[model samples]
Target: MSTVIKIENLGKQYRLGQIGTGTVSHDLNRWWAKIRGKEDPFLKIGEANDRTTKGNSEYVWALKNIDFTVNQGDVLGIIGRNGAGKSTLLKILSRTTLPTIGSLKVKGRIASLLEVGTGFHPELSGRDNIFQNGALLGMTKKEITKKFDEIVDFSGVERYIDTPVKRYSSGMYVRLAFAVAAHLESEILIVDEVLAVGDAEFQKKCLGKMKDVSNKEGRTVLFVSHNMGAIKNLCTKGLLLENGETKIYGEIDDVINQYFKKSDAAEGYFTSAKLDKSEVVFIRSIRLSNQTGRATEIFNTGDDLIVDLELESDEDISKPNIAVGIKSKNGFITIGNTMLDGNQMPDLKKGLNKLSITFRSIPLLPQEYFLGIGMRSYDCKTFLMTTKEIGYFNISTRMVDLGITKPMAEEIAMDSVSPFIPYEWDFGNGNIQSFNILNNVIK
Candidate 1:
């Protein structure tokens, strides 16, 4: 396969402080120098950030000496934490942003959906905007007309296709924007975390369309998303970036492992909490344990989870209320039953207390998870304290199930009422017995 995208020692630098503050004079000087065939006026700069302090530096490199090649028909996944230069790379590929250093080469026309309203004309009607975006992507008016109805239907905005996009809901805007980008023809597709919006059905449809576009049409796609699930499903290869540098490139799993190694906290917790009212109240630590009753980073499908909340309150009130929450990696908070209510007989006094909350069955499928906890007064109306991202845990399980975690099962003794078996008995006497499989099986 030919190299569709080649990035050679690519580097992008951003000056510290507000942009445009001191840029007008520099811009004018550079423009005149370029017109007069002279070197850039402000090319000399000291080495980047002092690494001593975490404070912002006068200059920073968003990408540094990056080199990679994407082959034709390759669906490459770019994974990185926020500000890791993933978007910078995508923007360079799409020509939205120019690299400050090095060079990049592309072999095909690219359509980028880097942001929610990117390439959209808010003043124009949705229908007109479709043609505008298509034309910008090198599609002729006739080609857009040929695919107009399909785009409208796919976007589910046929009724409002003539309305100005400014009036459309965020969902509606995303739907139409994504529809145009995904459906219209292009040699290369560049998407960056735009699928994080829209409903589940729309996300699924977009994923399906992306798969079809690459597999059937053999288009080269460069995708950047924080959603590991989507990345795993849509991309055949993964590229991990950290602090504007490529940490791992090639296989998806290898990239993901390297990404975790870099991003995970030192304590292996999703979050750390330091109570503000330290004089009166404080929370030292918290964690979720797996079935083996050990502090583990991985879990199985049917493991019983124990959430341990270790607290050190200077002086616990007469009645203290507390609740623990488990948030999915996608930010869905799964609220579990709490013991802080007056209905529970337990009394939480002063000093350090080790509270263990247990759940027989965990509903969440195998994935990274986050934890949140809260404390309140017994009145159930007064808020005492709350902690977010208390910790992070990994529930590592195979692809056995999709949505729900549990599957019902039953066992029977050899002599117990004949094991239920659903069957139709044909008797010559003209009488027959018929029963449901579950009913008979449990008989």
Candidate 2:
């Protein structure tokens, strides 16, 4: 495959409090240094873009030393926490912003959807906006006309196509905007998190269109999103960014693993600060472990997973119900409540108390999952305290555990579900097969 986009040492720096270097003196100083073929004085004083901590420098590199390439027909996913410079990098690639340093090369015309209603004039009707966007992509009137009906149909806003976009809802705006960008004849497509503004069905449609453009039409795509499942599904490659710097770039799975590794929840432990005092019962800490009591976040299939929870209450209370839920990217896989099994929780004291919930012989397939805790009233009407995603755990299957040979395991198709169900195969000729039959393990 040929490289369609190449970037080397790309960076974008910004003043902390003001624009244009914050002062004319600083601007003149930068100009003088540049005129003398010297490095900008401000660049030397810039600091890493750590938003959580206060820094002494007046300039911060929103993106620093980014280097990567996108080949023809490759769909690259850019992922990071908020303020990680994912959007900045996309803007530079879209030519909406210039990098502070380094160079990039693009081999073909680029179409970008960076934000809701991006490149759309709110005063113009959606129909007019589509034609305007197509023209801006260098498509002639004839070309725009050829794809107009398809765009309108895909957007599903034909009734309002002639209505001014300023009157459209945010979702409608995104639907029309994305329809235009995706259907246009650009060799490269750049999309940021703007697709999130659309509904789930529209988002799915957009993903399909992006895949079709890259796989069927031989175009390149760059996508930025916080949705890991979507990223894993669509992108051929992944780029993980952190603190405005490249953390990992390679295979999508490896990059995603590296991203999860940075999360404190992945450590399988969490402790609440003393400063976070609650009027009612509150979680103090959470710890995950294997049946052996060794704290860990990684587990193999059929492992006994345990959760140790600590809670503190200001006053003694009766009927304090606690619930725990395990969730994957799609949705909740299982939920265990103290009331479910007719086992009432013990009365809470005025101090900290410890509790344990064990899930024996977990059959979840290989994937990342999160644990959430909720403290509710006895009737489950009021929530005293709730923390979603307190910790994360991973589950992988072993060939031996599955009672299958390595080759057979490799050949088996895995479904996208948690808590793999056990089953048996029987042939009328007196042959029967069963595997991993551990049942009723949640406790």
Candidate 3:
């Protein structure tokens, strides 16, 4: 295998709240600066890509000085928060956009399925779009004809093959687009979160196809998605981008662990402006604590765990129930307790209230999970306030003997149903039982 894709000093700059030189003076200034062998004057005025802040500069770098490589037959998973320049980098790689600085070298035909109906014309039928996409990949008519059936069959959209893509639902669009990209003999495949539009069954099929392309066909893939499970599954390497900068690179598992280690608040306190709130009832505070009642974001599997919450209501509340739970990386509830889930709960007093739920032993397998909290009326129909994911925590099942601390996301069980460790066993020189199957007899 060779270095098929290499990028050096790649960067992308954008002007916030404006497109293409908001004013003629600014554009002239930039050009003048460049002609004088100087940096763009606007480049000196941009703020970091932090989404929460009110940016001070009109210019921002969606991506800056990113340098990495993708070798032949490598599946590199790129992950980060929204606005981390994931889409921008892919656009540059796919030739849909040009980087403001640096260069990219590509050695193979690239097939990119970026967004819903990304490459397809809304007026073109699915069948026609197949050929269109192939052409975009530099494929000839004969070659596309050869792979046409496989693409259509894989997409499972033959019934609507002749229908204009504009009529296709989001799911159907992604299925057809992905199918075309996967089977059209392209050497490099770049996929975004388009598969998120498909059903679970289809998502599974796409993942399998990606694996086959990389493992069997010896192709390269650049994938970006928030689905960490999928990232861990099909990728041998990972690249984590933070605020438009390269944070970590290399082995998939280590990169993911770095993400968690850098992301979650280990002190067990999480406060976000994105939490769901309303005037009726809203979250005042959310935290996680261990056995000692000290704030912590990391806990051992099968050990005591605690969740504390402070909520507020503007008006007198009646029959309000509180709920707390841990959500997996996939956004599913691993386990939780609710006041409305057959538990008698007290009414929340106006202004402020505090509650804590304690678990004798955390049953979760070794993994990292999100903290979820909600406040609602007892009837469950009245939505007072809720925060789907306000904080993050990790369950450490460090095997002292093996010195294992971090387990990959996919290796952990879905539900924390069983305690994975901390059990006792003893074997004395007492009589032992043995069985032999060769002679169909037990001895």
lDDT of 1 by residue, 108-136 (tens): 78888636776788999999999988787
Q: After superposition, how far is residue 361 of candidate 3 from its true place, in Å?
A: 4.3
Give lDDT per model, in order: 0.69, 0.78, 0.74
Give the candidate number with the greatest TM-score.
Answer: 2
Off by over 4 Å in 1: 20-53, 114-118, 122-125, 159-172, 257-273, 287-289, 292-296, 306-310, 315-322, 329-361, 366-368, 376-384, 396-443
RMSD of each: 12.0, 8.4, 9.9
User: Taking the tens digit of each residue's C-alpha lDDT, what string does model 2 give over 350-389?
Assistant: 8888777777677776667888877777787776676456
Superposing every Cα of model 1 onto the true structure, what RMSD results?
A: 12.0
What's the lDDT for residue 425 in model 2?
24
Greater-lDDT candidate between 1 and 2: 2
Assess candidate 3 and give its TM-score to the true structure: 0.74
Q: Using lDDT as the measure, which candidate wins?
A: 2
Number of backbone collisions per candidate: 6, 0, 0
Rank order by TM-score, top first?
Answer: 2, 3, 1
Query: Which residue pairs show collisions in model 3?
Result: none
1 or 3, greater by TM-score: 3
